[model samples]
Target: MSEKDQEVKDQELEEEVAELKDLEEQESVTDELTELTTKIDELDDQLLRARAEIANITNRNRNERELLQRYRSQDLAKKLLPAIDNLERAMATEVTDDQGMNLKKGVEMTLASLQQALKEEGIEEIPAAGETFDPNFHQGVQTVEASDDVPANTIVQVLQKGYKLHDRVLRPSMVVVAQ
Candidate 1:
């Protein structure tokens, strides 16, 4: 081959090689960019998930604190129930003379005040007499035959009063049930 022709062929081959290298470098750069973009997307998704989890935890803690605050007086109210019952029993006693009548009047006032205080604290008496008996709130110690006036599962009488604090029962009512 002639020298000039050989030189020209060599130059053409070098230019082609350079073009291939440029194309490969561009492809590598594009692949690297796509990988970086995918990594960033994954990191963003993880960040969002972590934020949602933190929000859920915060909400749960708030709800728990509210419940605790709402029922804070449960233990003390439960302890006071027997004292109120005693006062009620005292009120029920017969008084013959002036001193006895005065004492009974005082007992009635005390019982009323105690009940008011309990009501203010969200403690309340459970309704049992003449209502449908619920095992959750009433304990049937005795059973009587069902009559036309009182159906089965009805509470005939409450022997001892039941009390509750908010939605939670502090004590169940001891009752007689018609069966």
Candidate 2:
């Protein structure tokens, strides 16, 4: 080939090389943009999950606080049970004089009022006597031979009254079981 023809060929080859380089640079830029977009989406998803977790934790804590407040009177009502038992025992006693009878009446009214207050506060007596004995609500202090009238594991007598605060037992009834 002639010198001019060779020069023209060289110039064509150089232009093609420059075009290839431009295409490679554009592809590299597009790949970098795609990677950055993916990273942004992943970060946004993580932020949403963290916000949901925070909301759940806040709701759980609020429910716990409400439950605590609802049962706030449980301890005080439990402490007053012994005093109620004493009043009940006093009412059971026989009185001859007018003053003694009046005192007994007062005791009865006081006991009634105390029971009402406890009931309002969600404190209640656990049933024991004449019912089937349950370990959850009744504590068997003594066991007697099973009789035809009372089946095995039946509560024969309640030695001490049991009480509960709502569904939770505060004290188990001390009782005698037929077994």
Candidate 3:
């Protein structure tokens, strides 16, 4: 071949190599863009999850606050239960004289007022006598033999009355159970 033809062939080979290099660079840039887009999508998904978790936490805290507020008087009402029982016992006593009768009447009025107040605040007596013995609401202080009339795990008598505030037990009933 002549020198001029050889030079032309060399120039063609160089142009082809340059074109291939440009194509490779473009492919690399496209691959980089795809990877960056995938990373951005993952981050956006994480941000959405974070926001959802924050919302859940906020809702849970609000519910807890409302429950706390609703049961606010539970502690004080529980402490007053023993005093109420004593007053009830006092009411059961027989009085003869005018002074004794007057005092008894006063005691009855006080007891009635206390019960009304407790009822308004959602404090209530736990059903014990004639009910089946439930360990959740009744504490068995003594157990009696089961008779034909009374089944096993039945509450025969409530030794000390139990009380509750809403669905929560302020105090479990002390009771005698047939077992």
Candidate 4:
């Protein structure tokens, strides 16, 4: 081969090699960029999921707190039910003498005050007399034959009064049902 021809061939080969190196570098950079973009998308999705979970937890806690606040007096009201029942029983008793009458009056006043306090605290008696029998509010201890005046599943009598604190039943009414 002539010297000039050999030199020209060598220069051309070096240029091709440089072009290949540049192509490889460009391909590597593109692959690296794609990988970085995919990683960023994955991290963004994870961040969104974490935020949603935190929001759900916050809402659940708020609802629980509201329920706790609304029913705060439930326990104390339930405890006072039996005492109110006793007072109601006292009110129902017959008194013949003046002293007995005075005692009865005092009992009546005491019962009234307790009932007022309960009303103020969102506690009230369940109305069972003459109403339809309900297992949710009235517990039928005994059932009587249905009469023409009273239909089946109707409450015949309330043996003991039931009370409730707000929407929750503190106690179910003990009742006789016509069946």
Provide C-alpha RMSD values for all models, in order.
2.3, 2.4, 2.5, 2.0
The numbered model that scores best in TM-score is 4
| TM-score of candidate 1 versus the correct structure, residues matched by position | 0.84
Q: For model 2, how does the per-residue alpha-carbon lDDT over 72-171 read when each residue is reduced to its tens digit? A: 8878877898898899889879999999989988998899999999999888899999999999999999999998988999999999999998888988
Residue-level lDDT of model 1, residues 142-165, one tens digit each, is: 999999999999999899999988
Which ranges of candidate 4 are over 4 A from the true structure? 96-102
Against the unseen true structure, what C-alpha lDDT does each candidate score?
0.95, 0.93, 0.95, 0.94
What is candidate 4's CA lDDT for residue 58?
Answer: 100
lDDT of 2 at 173: 97
Q: Write the per-residue lDDT of candidate 3 for residues 1-179, one digit (tens) a residue.
A: 89999999999999999999999999999999999999999999999999999999999999999999889999899889989999989998999999999999999999999999999999899999989999889999999999999999899999999999999999999999999
- Model 4: per-residue Cα lDDT over 30-143, one tens digit each: 999999999999999999999999999999999999999888889988999989989988888999999999999999999999999999989999999999998889999999
| Candidate 3 Cα misplacement greater than 4 A, ranges | 148-151
Error of 1 at 22 (Å): 1.1
Candidate 4 collision pairs: none
TM-scores for every predicted model: 0.84, 0.84, 0.82, 0.87
Query: Between prediction 3 and prediction 4, which has the larger TM-score?
Result: 4
Better of 3 and 4 by lDDT: 3
